[model samples]
Target: MADVTHASNAPPAHLAAGTPPILELVNIAKYFPGVIANENVSLNVFPGEIHALLGENGAGKSTLMNVVTGLYQPDAGEIIIDGYGTTFPAPDAAIAAGIGMVHQHFRLVPRFTVAENLHLGWSETPRRLSGKDIEERASALSKKFGLPITPSAVVSSLSAGEQQRVEILRVLSRGARLLILDEPTAVLSPVEVGELFSALRRFRSEGGAVVIISHKLDEIMALADRVSVLRQGRLVGTHQTCDVTPDSLVTEMIGRPVTLATSYPRQSPAPAGGEAEPLSLKQVTVRDAAGVVRLDDVSLALRPGEVLGIAGVTGNGQPELAEVLTGLKAAESGTVYLNGKAANRADPAMFAHAGVGHVPEDRLKRALMPGLSVAENMALREYDRPPIGGRFSFSMAQARKFAQMLADRAGVKLPGTQVQIRGLSGGNQQRLVLEREIRIASHVLVASYPSRGLDIGAISAMRDMLARARDAGVAVVLMSEDLDEIFALSDRIAVLYAGRLMGVMDRADADRESIGALMSGRNLSEAA
Candidate 1:
């Protein structure tokens, strides 16, 4: 790889002009049992700046941020605020020092009112304020930041974007001068994202410092003033956003030149020849344990040798839809047809037997057993069959051999198949899951967020794998939050909003604007 570490060791240019950083870390280091999460990583956040932290998964961005936020005491480092060196004993201490972090998952109590949540951990309150007083304070902060919210509304009743606003306001309410946001836009709609960026710009214009961690290069380019890249727990470099291109950043992040697979050439599915569709849903309706309708009257079909991309924001019934298709969750009404035969009540094993493979959204919880060895985990869906094992017999040797073959084919990097699956990188683990599922999927495959957290290289490879599966006469249902991925991979696009099917259309007839409008609950005509 070409060296892109031009200013790896230089301090921000403002320092030479006698401006002190709002927050700074010098020679920070952190360690796990056998992993060095960070090593000699130094960075600075100046007032009125939006600094972006860029790294592939496991590149120490989280570890470094945790040290700054007082989640973990660094093994070695000096933290400076303004000009004074300080140590934070806990998150509260960090907050007291004008530092606050908004994690990807909001930390608000669902059942509590927005006002109550804002006051829950406020130590600066000299006296117990009444409910109305708290709401009044929250309302003032909301207006000050241009973030609208109903302080009396329960947190659970708010939308994802609304909940996020509450999180940001809570930090500002606590007098946070330097704010840190982790993957803040991952689950937001485009409109919400724009709203968030506008708010961040406003915060910066008021002389507040912000650090945002994200993998979306376009977002980084558009929002960040300066970008710092981390690789293998070391600082690759920090450069003004104007000085580097997106490709250079990717090269710095993964330490290699990468050709990102943005889109594939359109290909028509093979003729059905009077055969039934591989998978189809007929007015499927699903309700959760609480009697809430998770999937409402959804109907769709998947044809062999084609990719059907299901696009939606998070929490719009994507999970319930994927579960119903794979027979993991039964629908309250309507039917799931596998090759034209109703299979609504079929269990996972029965679906698997019918050649329906699923790569679940929650990889560890639903797909792989972390404690098991790689080979063992790979054998999960085939343990009772030949080669892997028999009904009353087992074959470790065959299992390892099968696993090694699949791992090599999938380009999964691992020490050996005997190592625990949890010990591998996220990309490798996802590859293992894909290999197992694809091998078993002769008719249909359902993959949910297959490349959600992987690095660029892994994402490229994953897209290739899914495309290959589709080309090999297997029907593929791809459930994804990324609009780019959906546009790049889908032959047909389906939009879901609040558990209802907004519409389905050919990829040729779809664009980000239309899909995005549907995702926000607009009908097809309105979206058009």
Candidate 2:
């Protein structure tokens, strides 16, 4: 057990003398088959407060919140809302009791109009409603919360940030007094984040309580009024935001001292002029299966030993750009060059043979085979020509040995090589993918959102690995929404907007203000 002080039922010191908490968890515990998800954990959320929940991956934050939202029943504990004990048999029951949760992945139906999506599962709403009636209601709620949205607009046509606003509006429309947001800012740009924070502040002023689950320490520090740290299924502590620092919260979350790197010092500068480009794209145009252009006239060159960071808001052609580079998708027009040779129609196998490695955005869907053993997944790239495989025979022993060595070297924590890859946490799975890709990438590597869902410690480790790969002369194309990560690792930053390359700037010339402007589809001069 960690050195933690158990929270008592007494009111928090920072709250008004007699104001009770809007919600309280008294000694919550949840158990699974051979797993203790949470134990004797207690927390409090006051009215009009933004309480942040901080923890590493698999640290019981989700379990506790699931209990609160009625997705899971606690083995032992009491949930109190407004000074009365209650049991939430289901999510709807919780929502009816003034609690609502907005998941990281929006639950809206993309094809439906905003008003139609908001009325989904709304028992209080009439089964038959006029479009105007629902739109008017949704508009009123949006204005009340300071969240702007087009009630008649189709959800699919909205931007990532706008979609998030719809999700929040849906929750608020349910008569919720307490709102819980999970990783709400994960996909938004800096400007959108500011807008969200402002909306949340307005909600707070209206006496609505909020509990935010986030991995970014800076966001938590900036937005939270109180923060609670969880570690290994126990409540470490809860303190007022003014009473704690980010470093202190980090120490409590991981139980160690980890200095997160804000900038990576390059071991050597990238090779300069006249060095043949490892990979280049010239006037490349790509289209989706539906014939929608996703990349338009984009040109880029990847140099030896450089991290070319791709920055953009989500759905602005980052995926298309990555797919074109990795040979997963073909360019509709123009050319893709590998070492000055036009390899326009090259397939994934050809890219692999040419020493190109890819860490895709959706790792589970695109990178790893969840049902397979760790060893099998680890050796997936080299199975055909390795000690683990012959022309007709496969060596499980060699495969296990090879995987064990890589796991140890990459600091992936798992029971054994025979365990299913799905059993490991997100961070460990990512580490496995990165280690395998780095080993295979001799010339070029394309990594997209490599640290998106990882904890602070895992994020630091991932950044170090990318830096080491760059040092080893791999031309890295890192596509990320995180400006900090981009600035830390990128020698040059490329901004993409609406399938067009807005501009590319050297790290020395780029700042958040400029990058954010470009991300929102403004040129440098317009930004100025």
Candidate 3:
């Protein structure tokens, strides 16, 4: 709890003639149990600049930021802010020193208006502050920052982009001089990204500094004035953004030459004009609990040996479509056919019985039983009616054996069959789910956000599994927000907007701009 404000005895020899750095870390090192999260990391953020911290997952970028924000204390290093040596015992101390961090998840209350949310924790506000006064002040700040949001608008009604702006505005309202954002563009569309960039430009022009922790190389080049790379808890190097290429940055990050390819090689279109559909949804309409139309007369057809990708921003009826197809939610209208036979939409077990498989978006909530052992979780699909068990009784030994076999086939590394799945890594758990769903799926497989939150190795493994399934004539429906995943693995891409199918395009014809426009609610035909 030492005072965090200080004036340096002398400026560093490396610094050119300019204002002293707003924030500086020299030889910052932090460690956790049996892990070295960061070592000898030195970073400096000058006023009026965007500095990007680049690294793969577990490269200590977050750890470094945590140390800066005083969430963790560095075992060794000097933190100097505006020439002052400081120690921040907690986040409050960091905030006291004009540092604030906006995590990927926004912290605003959905039920509250923007002004109310922004004023929630302010101590200097009048006890009888009027809503109109708050709104006017918030509106002025937002307009000054190039983020034009209505202060009276409900937080729930704003788009993801607007919500992010609110978070930034909240920190700025607290007099934050250095803003840190982690994976800021991970959930934003291209258009939203542009808006965010404009806002950041405004912040920089007003003498604020930004530290953006992200994996997007293009975005770094686009917005960052300087870039720093971390690898295996160690500082690799730092450079001016204009001086390095994407390939050089990749090399610095991973210690090798990397292509950074998103999609695998495109496959030839299947010539199955006369083949019967593997899965078809004819004029399906779905409604949510609030009587809002979630899916509006949606129609789709999947042929055997083909991969159909559904592309859209999150919350655009993709979940509803997945639910309707997986038998979790019944369509209020229209017919569902599985392998050319009409299936009952109301029956949750019908799709599984008809040889359809599902990989839900939320693995923990929908697919995984974390408390159970790995083998037991693997038996979730067919323990009751399989060769691994019997109709009247279950067989743990057979289940273990089958699980091991499938684990091998799916390239999932497990400590043992008896080990609880909760201890397994996110990537391994996903591997198990993919293994069971793909093996049980006879005609159609629906995978939602299959590669989300997974590392590069895990992502490659999943793409391989999906490709094998497509090769084996299993019609695959891949619904993902990651356009790269869709473009890489899909034969055809279907764009969705506001619960309606905007249009479907061949993979060859899809580009980022057209797809970005469609994701932002422009119809595919209009975008074309």
Candidate 4:
């Protein structure tokens, strides 16, 4: 378990400090209608220190951040900057106080250039647009910080990490002394995360304080100077960074202790049903704009009662690969074979029929209709089927029954079947998607980041479902950035880096360290 100083039943105050804290929260309290978001929570961040704010989903971390960043006013509490206690009614107030926050979601204007993005909110007069002054300033900052950002690069052309750096530099250029990054690594590639951590280290060395709010325990163990744990709207405890291990932190974050299972295979895989082949991808090549090959020469095959895992860094054609597999995006070349028949790239309607269930990576964009009711969203996968009935019409009874069953199976905590998907939290929405995909899939299931937004319990449940699927003669193709997820769920792992299939390895042969190396493209070392 992660070594931690667990707080008592009575909430504890910030630890003793030497110099004045750069930022301090005193007895912070926030309430949203019937919900008590945070109750008398306190925290202290020192200069040159990276403070990790740890919590599970709905554990009041976002709420507390919203309060600090001036998105919401705390019902009662004191915020001290440098030394004086203050309250912010607006973001400008927080900005003026040298506090800046970057949200998990990107907010960049896609059409803007990096220079233009950097100068968007500046009060300085510039008769010329995209001027040399702006270029020089951005370039200089990039060089100084080893950021590798091009001043003239279009915002739309930058990767997730580059865009994040742009956000950070924009705030820092305005003389901000403190920064709050909420789940900054959520969208990052493994390489990008390493670079980001290096930059954070440099920033801290220069005396800027940072607070990184994340669910990634290893990251905190590597980077944080002090860690604050929050559970169910209360401060659990605060411990010095060096004193806590990843296992200890995980235990604290989840409230009760958890012994994470490694690459330990349990009962023998069940026998696959009657001689039916599962999935086959033949010569799949996805090309993008500028004639760049997103996926080149991709071919694979799997049998029933097997889990084929795809492990790759983000943006190396994983999304493109999934689109082809899920029937969302067409491949420029090649065909998909389900149950020994060619699949026409006509529509996703075929996947449900072909027994190819797909849980896409982007939940908001691809999987669920956020504006629709949970029932309606779940019914999306069921509409063309018998029970939900549709030669040309609808069966209200079947639809409602199916939706209710799925909602219950997924453990979605919404008001009812009629509750909008938007009303459900991130984890719940993910669970809904999982249930929808798993319930209807016939032969092969391709789940991409299936548990990306789920909590620990939800993640475990999803993993169990995959295990059960393997046990039931279902072919499972899983793709994820989470190493533990890949290790726990996949029987065989395929590494993809730079749109190339590196190789496949047995789950028993792949370790975290090995997979990490392969993910970075040194497959030989990883294999060795």
Best by lDDT: 2
lDDT of 2 by residue, 224-302 (tens): 8878988888988887777788898889999997886878887876566787898999999998877898999999999
lDDT, model 3, position 442: 83
The Cα RMSD of model 4 versus the native structure comes to 4.2
In Å, residue 294's CA in model 1 sits off its true spot by 5.6
Native-to-model Cα distance after best TM-score fit, residue 1 in candidate 4, in Å: 19
Error of 1 at 350 (Å): 4.1
After superposition on all C-alphas, the RMSD of every candidate to the true structure, in Å, is 4.5, 4.0, 6.2, 4.2
Model 4 ranges with Cα > 4 A deviation = 1-17, 125-128, 131-133, 144-146, 263-269, 369-380, 383-407, 415-425, 451-458, 506-528
Residue 336, model 4, lDDT: 78
Q: How does candidate 2 fare on TM-score?
A: 0.84
The local lDDT score (0 to 100) that residue 412 gets in candidate 1 is 72
| lDDT: worst 10-residue window of model 1 | 1-10
lDDT minimum window of 10 residues, candidate 3: 1-10
At residue 210, what lDDT does model 3 achieve? 93
Candidate 2 or 1, higher TM-score: 2
TM-score ranking from best candidate downward? 4, 2, 1, 3
Q: What tens digits encode model 3's per-residue C-alpha lDDT throughout 1-528?
A: 011111121222333556678988888998765567799877678888788888766677877887899988999999999898999999989988899998755688999999998888787567887889999888888776667788999998888788998998888878899999987876676788998898888888888899998866778899988788888788777777776898888877778765535665535455457888877899999998879999998999988888899998888899899888878888889888877878745665778877789999778768988789988988888887767777798989988998899889887755578778765556678888999999778888999988765545467678988988887778899998878889888989998889998888888898988988888798867787
